[model samples]
Target: MRILAADIGGTNSRFAVFRVGPGPLEREGGLTLPSAGATDFISLLERVWAGLGAGPEDFDAAVLAVAGPVRGRTCHPPNISWGIDLERDWPGPTPCLLLNDFLAQAYACRTPAVAEARVIQPGTADPRGAMAVIGAGTGLGHCALLPLERGFTAVPSEGGHASFAFVGPEEGAYEEFLRKETGRPYAYGDLVVTGSGLSLLHRFHTGRDLTPIQVAAELRPDSPTLDWFARFYARACRNYALTVLATGGLYVSGGLAAKNPTVVDNDHFRAEFINSPAHAELLRNLPVLLNANENSGLYGAALFGQRALEHATGLEA
Candidate 1:
């Protein structure tokens, strides 16, 4: 079946075409465009379609994994001014589906046929246990997959917006700093573990006001931003894993993890992740993997669309 999938983020959107069969998915190609180039969601879709020289009707089904909370069929990413209404805004009659981008990443983990993902921590992978995913990109996103009779089911979450917990005196001071900057009583995990968050932390840790790009370029073993960001992310991951009881595995994806893998591959990250006082042993036993393929989101959307299409066909028959 012909399928179209789009992974839409705050800063960019990637589109891909696929043909699914009994074996595996065959990808045609993909296009990436700056999301802010358009003023509205529909216009962005139009531009993507025109650039591909195809109409929405060309696809059998479509799925859009968006970087925001999806309530029913509508989504409004906090960073973007445009809102998406799946029911009203679809450009064609193709059966369309909307999913939180991290939910798509979770689906990618359960995809039966996918490239062998990199295992950052080689703790045993339990197929029967729950799987979790945490990705730090433009923002932090978290999701889980529950094992089912056949495979797994994606459970979308807004855990990224959960209150940020200060694990120590240093983090406590950082919390006060953020409160003073935003005039808020509390901070969210997204504010401390994202691309923008790294920039903010860099400024606070080193008294250097560098842009995100500059910070990324400067990140290394000796960089204070890298050390702090890695530990902060590890702490967040440990908390979320405990909350979800993710014994299956916890996979990390997104631009930040993908770009600077060394941040997660060091002793700092491992120490912080396994720092839980009572459950340190349990944390150490759980696997931590990386979704190294940046296109995993696109592939995941295709998998979702393919499943929906097949289910619809079975119902019709």
Candidate 2:
């Protein structure tokens, strides 16, 4: 079946056409466009399909993953300006599925299409346990894959917006800064661990305004910004792992870590990730992996599309 998959994050939107059935899933064509330029998803989708030289009629199914909570057929992504309502905006007579972006990442675990994920923590993993997926990009995302009777079920979360835990005098100061910077009652995970958070952290240390890319590019040997970001990133991962009891594994899948792996691939991150006072041993035994493939989202969306198609036809076992 022809599946048109779209992975829409806060910063960038990626679209691809996949042939998912009977054989290996295949990609025909795709495009990545900046989500900043457009005011709506359908218009940007028009440009994306146009760039691929194919329109909606060419595909039998579509799966759209956006970085926000999905309500029925509509979603208003937190980071992006525009929201999408498949019921109102989708064109042509085709099947379309809406999903939270992190939920799509959850479905991506162990899929052959996005198999080259890197290993950060090589701990023992329970094959039947639940798996967690977290990533930092335009924002922070959290989700999990719970092992079920026959297969796995993807659970979406909006925990990134929840209050972030801060400890110690140093982190307490940072929390105050986060509150002042974000003007929120409490510092949330998305604001503390996202790309903008990196920039804000850098600004806190250096008192200079620099883009996330610039900060990453000008890293010194002992850059405090990277160090703190790594610690927080690890803390976020560690918390999510414990919350899900992700004995199967914990996969970090996001553009931020994918682009600058050093954030999650260092001693600082390692120390913080396994630093549970009561359950350190339990946390230490779970594998920590990173999906560096930016297109893994698209792969996941297509995989989900295939699954949905099968279920609709009562072919799912």
Alpha-carbon lDDT, every model: 0.85, 0.88
Candidate 2: 10-residue stretch with minimal lDDT: 308-317
For each of the candidates, the C-alpha root-mean-square deviation to the true structure, in angstroms, is 2.0, 1.9
lDDT of 2 by residue, 18-53 (tens): 998887788888888999978788789879777989
TM-score of each: 0.95, 0.97
In the range 243-287, model 1's lDDT, one tens digit per residue, is 989999899888888887876877789999999879999999999
Looking at model 2, residue 47 earns an lDDT score of 92
Task: State candidate 2's TM-score.
Answer: 0.97
lDDT for predicted candidate 1 compared with the true structure: 0.85
Q: Which candidate achieves the best lDDT against the true structure? A: 2
What is residue 271's positional error in candidate 2, in angstroms? 0.5
Q: Name the top TM-score candidate.
A: 2
